[model samples]
Target chain A: MSSSKLHPLYKQLLRAFTSRPSDLKTSGRLLAELKVVLIETGLIFPQTDYSTQDLVIAREILEIGAFWSIRTKAMPSFDRYFSQLQTFYNDYSSILPHSEREFPIRGLNLIRLLIQNRIADFHTTLESLPLPADELIANPFIRHPVNLERWLMEGSYSKVWNAREEAPAEEYKFFVDSLMGTIRNEIASCEEAAYESLPLKDAATLLFFRSQSEVLDFAKQRGWLIDLTRGVITFTQKGEEKLEIPKEKLIANNLAYARELEQIV
Target chain B: MADVEMKDAKSKSDAKDDIATPPLSPVSEIKSNVTLIERAVSTLEPRFTIRVLRSLTALRKRLDDKALCDAISEIYPQDSQVRSSLLSWLPASPTQDESMEVDPSPSPKTPSETVPETEIYFRLLILHHLLASPSTYSEAINLANETVQKIQSLNRRSLDPIAARVWFALERAYELGGELSDARHLFLAAQRTASLRHDDETQASLINRLLRSYLHYSLYDQADKLISKTNFPTSAPNSQYARYHYYLGRIKAVQLDYTAAHTNLQQAIRRAPAPKLAPGFYQAVHKLFVVVELLMGDIPERSLFRHPVLEKALRGYFDIVKGELPVSYSVRTGSLSQFQTTLSAHAVSFESDRTYSLVARLRQNVIKTGIRRLSLSYSRISLRDICVKLHLDSEEDAEYIVGKAIRDGVIEGRIVHEKGWMECGGQKTGYGPEVSEMFSRRIGYCLELHNQSVKAMRYPLNAHRKDIVDAEGAREREKELAKGIQKGEIDEEDAMGGDF
Candidate 1:
């Protein structure tokens, strides 16, 4: 629980985290121990009373925990670490030395929101960033998700498909890949609505799949009819139901307005 | 000769009255205002309380330790504990010359019965005075905390108006001390109590205070949650309504619900005080309003900037609005570099106004404008040329951006991916479903407006009888006045000028 005790645990965490082919189990265990030490030192919540050295270490530990959560795909834990880091990043920003991990972690959070399709929250997070918009866009870490959000809004799935190669960090690829999965599903639905059938090669290219087998697998999952001889996939057309206008509700609403006007007169 | 003249004037003034009344000081003036508030409480007339509050702005500048101390000592009896506590909050006066002469003369008929309203008013003044200096902000915060507790414990109905004022001071103290979030629970608890007690004024004030606290930390989610959980009292004053609408506008704008945000900002502007009276609030509201308007793709009226209140505060916003003019010119001409330059130039102000993200979203409009121009000028364009003209990073990005523009119906176009060129089609000129949809929307809006206007019309009770009676009385008075004038009993100047 003491600073001397936390130092070794943190160093171990860093080693486990940075090791090529990171051992999630060892880093996870180390993070748990580090959290306990942080709670004991009263550095977990980042009160003003804690020494600056302790606060810095506590912040770094949480940052590593955030990255670990992403690596292990434990999104809820990532959210917890993010909320905890918020205090250190914001409240203690004046006292502590700036952490290089801040923007990368924040960018990852933004990308995580985008992957989850929480576009409103993505923007809220962007607005909450301390830096100005231009500076944030200039940060490659922040720019990746911001650009992805714009591309997503524009219905430009191909650009998002290409963005996976340009992720700012290795860990960012995890979220970017998930984002691509969402985009593929979107592109699949659009293809379904637009066409009755397409050749396998063209479908593969349209869906950004490098191999025909991946398109077939995705097609099978979507319940499309595939022909082996012609190598064509057919989309099942939904029935074209006639639009039914709610006549009664419209009339009732008009009557109510008329009645209210009558009373006013 | 000057000495002789001074003696003559002094003797002449001395002979005017045997006992000279002390000259009126700020302390005496404030003491009288406190008495007026007491009279208001006793009579249940709130207008007096409002009058006292109106004078507080001017009186705030004249406050000092001696003035507050003098006022408190005069208001409370020598044996009163409230007097001592109130005096303790103010620093002891540094000057002794005036105190030595005035210390011994406590008002002879000091009332043991001190109204809690007066005590809270004194605390409010002292809180504002303390807040004037950064060094004393902590003390102000402490005093604010103690005052809130006292208001809660006293639970007096007469203290409701003063309690609202005290809460304003309390919020200021905490905000200026840079510990606004720490007082969130305090505001929440007090708000609950105020609502339960049916204290609408304090409840309204506390809700605003709580929203502001949440917003100060950029806790928009919590602010939105607080808003949904609590119902703002419909009977709250216009000022409170203005504040509520302003905060709602801010929350909605950040959430990208531009339509709702625009309506809320308009309501805020409508409910706000006259611009000259509260220029800061007026400017703040309009700053958000202009940004929301731009985001909604409507240009604010050119006359808006000519208003005396807005001309100075909206200079930066005017530039941004001006940059938007070309977008509306032919719907095809927009300068991305101009938008970027204007945005970066006003970036600091926009950031200060918290509209940077919303303004930055205008870049999309710039791109759309570029695409519209490209579609108009060319029957077909290669992706490379599009990239070069639009300053895009690459052909692929240009293809995607142009495809997006086509899908969004910003232009009638299709991309030939294999050839890497876009085919532009002519604009649709015939009547379409979209035209009918627009007409229906307009018709619905008109009907709704008519219905609302009808509902908003108020009819006073027995209005015809009252009008008749008023008319008869006015006629009788005019007849009497005319007779008097004919008899030369009234002077022409008095007859016409005085009445007018």
Candidate 2:
């Protein structure tokens, strides 16, 4: 209702929430413009006397900014917006959007931390939730991150990857995809070390790539040689010398496995 | 008319014979002598009254104030003409100058100066004054100080009884004015003098009074030290013993020793003066008893709520605990918010009665109850379900509560961390050590109840009236039988057939 009388910068920033940024360039441009307007109003410095509507609008813009940073895989930018949202919630929660909007972003923020392998920070974030885990998980937004964390801890890569499709909000999908990407790379590295080579089709599925071209690009980055006629990718030796494996560790692993087998009996 | 005349003649001759014969012990001698004064005062003869009053005045210097007051009160009640003459020695109300004139040595004298009989009577009067009109507390304290000064100046070793009583009055004044520290300080000083004189009654009563002050101010360490350092009397006046147990109960309750606290509180309730005589002390002990029972994780007996005196005070807790919207319902149904509201409603009353700590434990009780119900409903419930049911924040918190419950023997279960499940061991059965211990405690309680009832029973010849002793015994037996059936020690069908 007060849309017409809002500051010009506030109006422009409001666009971020109304429409999703089409590409990284547009998102980056909109974020830069937001930063300039926020600085000019001294809002970045926490200027006083902003109306409740203004604070609400500012919180919405920051929420979108957080999603953009996650989508672009920029963690520091995401942290900045998330912390600002936290301040807004702490100070102006009465005027800001409902908890429904806030919890999903927090959930996505947790996914980003998981993807970045910040286990300690992930737990710290989970600990900060005011709601109990049971009540918290009842909300789809909050449950998405919690389930992701549990699945990741279980080392269930497939479950973590499948979780992307079930994200509660559109912005959550960005971080879920990022988490899957990290899981895929982790599996790729383990596969490379465990085996000399694998067929292209197996490699594509293992890497969670829908097409061979994506897997091919990834293989190039890992310095693997592809034989299109043979339908196989070959691992290249790094140096002109033989690499020795640690026999002690292999024996330790075997001993542990044997103890576990004895326990099963 | 002839029979009444003969009965009066026989009573008078018996009284004369009792006095003519000296008693075996000094206690019996004094008892018979006091009764002689009572008989003489009833004749309304001026000569007999004067003779008895003079003898009592001489004996007052040697006897305890309590016995002197009791004997003299027979001739002169507080408002009598003789009592007014005794009051001429008190420093208040323009009597100080006249009393000073009688002290021929106007200048300060040492212990040898005549220890007036009226000085002991003055302290007695001051104690009565303080007890009746609380506004005179400061004035009473000032008078006590002056008397202590005079007694110390007299410097007589045998006047310790007089000094002890003066300090007792001072302590009562300090306690009345809410100056607990001063009261305790006076108690220590008086105890030293009373003990040195080997005055057992005064010292025992003083310790009982001091323990109550310690409890009121929550000076638990001081109370514990006094109990340990002092040689308690094997027997004392019933009122003093009752107070001793009541304060001991409060101290133990503060220390969270509910078992010992329960024993002491029950004793206090039993030994307390009748409700008509000291309702305040009687009701206070009863309230604390209820709290101790609750802390022990056992519901108070329903009969406790039926007392005309205790019903009004205990109704709130009874309603929240056993009435509609019971705390158990909240826990079993996961209605934490409702439980919280109920607790807060009674918080003020609980704080005033000093049962706030025990009542605050209700939250943990509710949570444990929720976990136990969950265990019964599902053999293996995920930590998430426990969290939901207990309104806990996380699986880790639920795990911690469940782990504590298992350790405390409130529940039997193992937590599987990897699977995040609490695998309940179902309900433990068989005559294990825990069951045997429980059985022993129940038997101990039943025996204690039986012993108390026996001690509490009235004469069998008077059994025509409503016998509280019989009723309490029947109630306890019913409770024991019900518990036996619940524990499966007695089959219900067998109980019915056996009864039939």
Candidate 3:
């Protein structure tokens, strides 16, 4: 398909998404957090959920996937409402990192693990109740209520699995495969963040700070990346003194980016 | 925060520093890794550029002992930063008032002998400094010779036939600095060292360099014998020996032997297409080829320098040589008149017609495009030093002329050479070149030199003018050579551009 139609729509969408149009329930403070999640949810289910509905909220969270506590701190007045919301998000909370935190990719995998445990507990609860199968489906809301099992394949729930095979001929195999795939996928996404790439000059500055400090352990624990000279840093002797100069490291670009430039993958 | 700026690749500053300076031949590093990291830190400016250099020096010298020689078989020089630090270490003259008020203190030079490393380092530092200082070449040579006699392992440029001292004096010979016999002896001495070394590429390269120096005085026989003997790999014989072919080829062209010239020229072109050619060689090759092709009547219709065969050769050499050429050219103050006057004194007068046209072309294409820039700057050292070394005239006359040339932007100034005076940035005018501008300036230099030498043959005591026949015509003729010294390695006695 031609990209002529593509540019304007994306341009319009970006502007609309960035602009928070209206306040939501519990004011707009919580709405931004909700907005972020809805964005991740919408991106995964762009076909399933219409972009016109409650999307500005989701786009914010989808953009960075920063935690709700960080968002709450960014908006201080609605503390109690976020406090209530935090419990549903967290368990056994004293404002925890939450066994199931938000969608920062890393936290998503943790949340997946927590949800799996919660699902197991719900199954156990049903087993202990001894409820008849018809009775479970007998309630007005339970009577074939929106068979979300189909949505599971496309919605946010299923996207937690990697883009690779989520289905299997063998039930046991698919479970293990998708779980591992999801973990790897999240790690890959988080690794691509800007914070991870320490520019050489910046790294040098950071290293200088490290050298000045007596505490090497503290600096190392910070997980800060240290960039080496990247290439040969030789001195060209000029008159009274020699001066040092940097040689930048050059690496081949990712195949996908090169494809865009040269129009070949 | 200090703004980090990349130094211009061919800054006049860098060129002037390298010009006439002996090889730094710095001692090997005692430790490479720490110094590399330290240099990185210093440059990245944890504090400042100079401060880091100073700190690196201290760290490098913070060694325990040289007695660990058995473990450390080779000794590299301390961090390069030490040289800069040592400059500050120069002892200042004691003030009478301070001297009278001072409590008794021990001299820092105490037992300077016991510290072998310090002694060697300081002595070498003095030599290095003197060599680079525009006016201090003679002083540096003296200090280096004085120190060389006492050292064990020498890391000098191995300038035999002309002992290091002799070469130093000869360079100053233009200023009447050293005795001619002494200079010859030193040059020969440098040649002797090459003979002693095994017939390796490095040894061959050094031999070639020395031979080039010999050829400067038209020592054809010696240069020929030296080239023939080098056991270089035939494909590339004699140290970086592509030159061997060029020299032979040049001789053939000059002899009007087209067949021999063609064969030699072809060989030289093939071998030196990308060989580390000097600026002179590049221009010389083009010169030789033009004469050969013209003499052979092969390219009567083709431009001399622009002929395909020669153009490729010129481009190949210049691509590498330009890197070494000065980023800019500087004209000595009062240099234009001196050049004209100097020319008028000679029979081969530079009539305004040719110079005017060329100067106009240069102004239009080079200066406007910034391919070349003209600057005027003060000279602490000038050609006066050369005059003094050669015993040509009084220090005053040489200085006066050099000073005037500097003002007129004719010749460039030397390092804190004590040959001239200082002036403000705008006050001390000079000329510099971009790659393209170099061509114009070089042409200008050739014409002026030609004029100067022709005068020498008349009544001006041109004892050396015999070496410079028709230098003025060389520049216009060497136009095909526009491509030869781009990387800037090519330096010729008279770098004449040929219009191939």
Candidate 4:
């Protein structure tokens, strides 16, 4: 805020500062981001406006992101920030952002949103979204150069008078999650383009996707994954179907393949 | 102005000792000799430039080849203060000639008699700097062991404002090296020095350090004992006192006296007032509180314990000790993380298969002193049991380890823990456990050191009467001051005098 050409760290603070009317290029783009955030998480609610009381929760989450972005951007070690990404998931948003009041965009809420979108045929399971691995290098989770920098200057803080970097483990986790989420989206988009209409649902995670049957089962527990058991489960048929962009399209591609063939049979 | 100078002397620990004696050490002589050698090796003996090359030379020659370091330790300066201060930083490897690497212990300014005021703490600080670097453990342990042994050789009282600092540094080294007993002993010893200076600010600062070492060593009794010694918020202002309470909170928290732990820890946070106390402490404490709360499931946050800082402080402190943070910053700000990392690294590099030999001393002390009141204390756990656990070659090695434990006050019985359990000195009344636990170790130690047990044991419980008398005397004195205030004999400004 003090200097123009805001630092990446200040971007979090800036994002939090302008919570009501978020600067997401467009509200549509912002919702797209939010929808993805929701899909990955299992928020308790399908939708909660970040206009009133929820705004405070959103701001805190954003501030926490900014704080870690500041620290992560300064570190030099990639592994260190990666390790911290696990902690970020557990500490910051694994549970709902409920100090006194619950924010709807918590872990389960996000998961639920994805489930709803997937049911309605939203874009695709976010995991399948295309993302650039290089973009991930900038994602705080992978950007360990900042941590290495901090490590390099471990004794630097004391040798000179300077403000210590904030290291709230919880807040740090939030930053890692957001960055990783962004990276995941980036990678998902890339993989989506690469694996267009694959037989498997998690074609983006193609290497790890189990047989078509296993993917269907895993999708059942995690409704965010589509169930294309035999494509007979489709709500629309053939080219007449207009997809509404599901929050999660995990099972769709695999399930669609299985279902499309089964429907023909 | 002269009055101001004399008044400041009230808190200067060295003022009294400086009037008396001044004797430099054999180590200092060796140090200066080493300086000469370093000067020969490279013109700049103490520079990082010189050190890198010298450390390489020493490494090539392998200084651990023989008793070179032990000889160097003995050959250090002759003045007790200089010798002890320098020795306190000597490497633990008796074979390591650390001076061979560093040479002439560079003072920021050259050393001189009437010891140029600045150079007084210079060596202790350098030792601290070495410890704070992300060095290996063998080097750190070697450094730490030498540090304390050398400091012991000095007349601590004679150390300037620097002496208190020297002791503080020594305590940190001891703590990091896992010499908990020695650390607590030195910490208490520092407290005594702080009290002698009558400098409450310095005393209070040291008190917090002492309290943390007490917790780490699991010396809850001593920490608890300390609480009754001074009133809360009296030693320093609310902020400083809050830190003190936070440390005590940590002790209680670690001890698992949840009710009391919460009460005090919360008050600590409330009183700390400053956020820079490092919220990590609050977070750690809060997490612990949350843990206890979850464990209890329905327990309410007790009053006076609602705000916790110890957990946060602990998180911060642990990361520091673990070398999760960089060593450079910790060196200046005074985190002992570098020392622990170095010590651990030392154990791994040289000793191999064991990275905890130094820490065994803390266990050894507990085994010897048997201070079970500290909670889950090793002292009550039995030596035979520990021998089996630690895998000593024989009971003698176990006993040797226990002797170190006795030094930690971690265990009980001096002779039983000491190697020569059979030998009886002139005043040895029955070295065996004939009496209660309280009188055993403290009494035996007094007799061993003083040889006048009859009078010493005559008041075995505590010098409580003296303590009461002191308190009563203070209350009576304060009443007179109150009366003076009432009578307008003392001005309001006078009553509220003294800067914090």
Best by TM-score: 1
Candidate 3: which stretches are off by over 4 Å? A1-265, B1-133, B143-181, B187-190, B197-202, B226-239, B254-280, B300-500
Candidate 3 lDDT score at position B121: 43
The CAPRI quality class of candidate 1 comes to: incorrect
- Note the residue pairs that clash in candidate 1: none
Clashes of each: 0, 4, 110, 120
Tens digits of lDDT, candidate 2, B226-245: 88899766444466678888
Candidate 2 lDDT over A78-103, as tens digits, reads 88998888777654555556655688
For A200-227, candidate 1 gives per-residue lDDT tens digits of 8878877788998898889999999999
Model 3, span A66-166: residue lDDT tens:
33332323323223333343322322222323332222222222223333433322222222221233343343222211121111211222223322243
lDDT of 2 at B286: 80
lDDT of 4 by residue, B95-181 (tens): 333433443333323233223222233344344545443333345555544544443444333232334344455556655666656
lDDT measured at residue A103 in model 1 versus the true structure, 0 to 100: 92
Worst 10 residues of 3 chain B by lDDT: B363-372
TM-score of each: 0.75, 0.44, 0.25, 0.25
**Between candidates 1 and 3, which one is better according to TM-score?**
1
lDDT for B489 in candidate 1 is 99
Order the candidates by DockQ, highest first: 1, 2, 4, 3
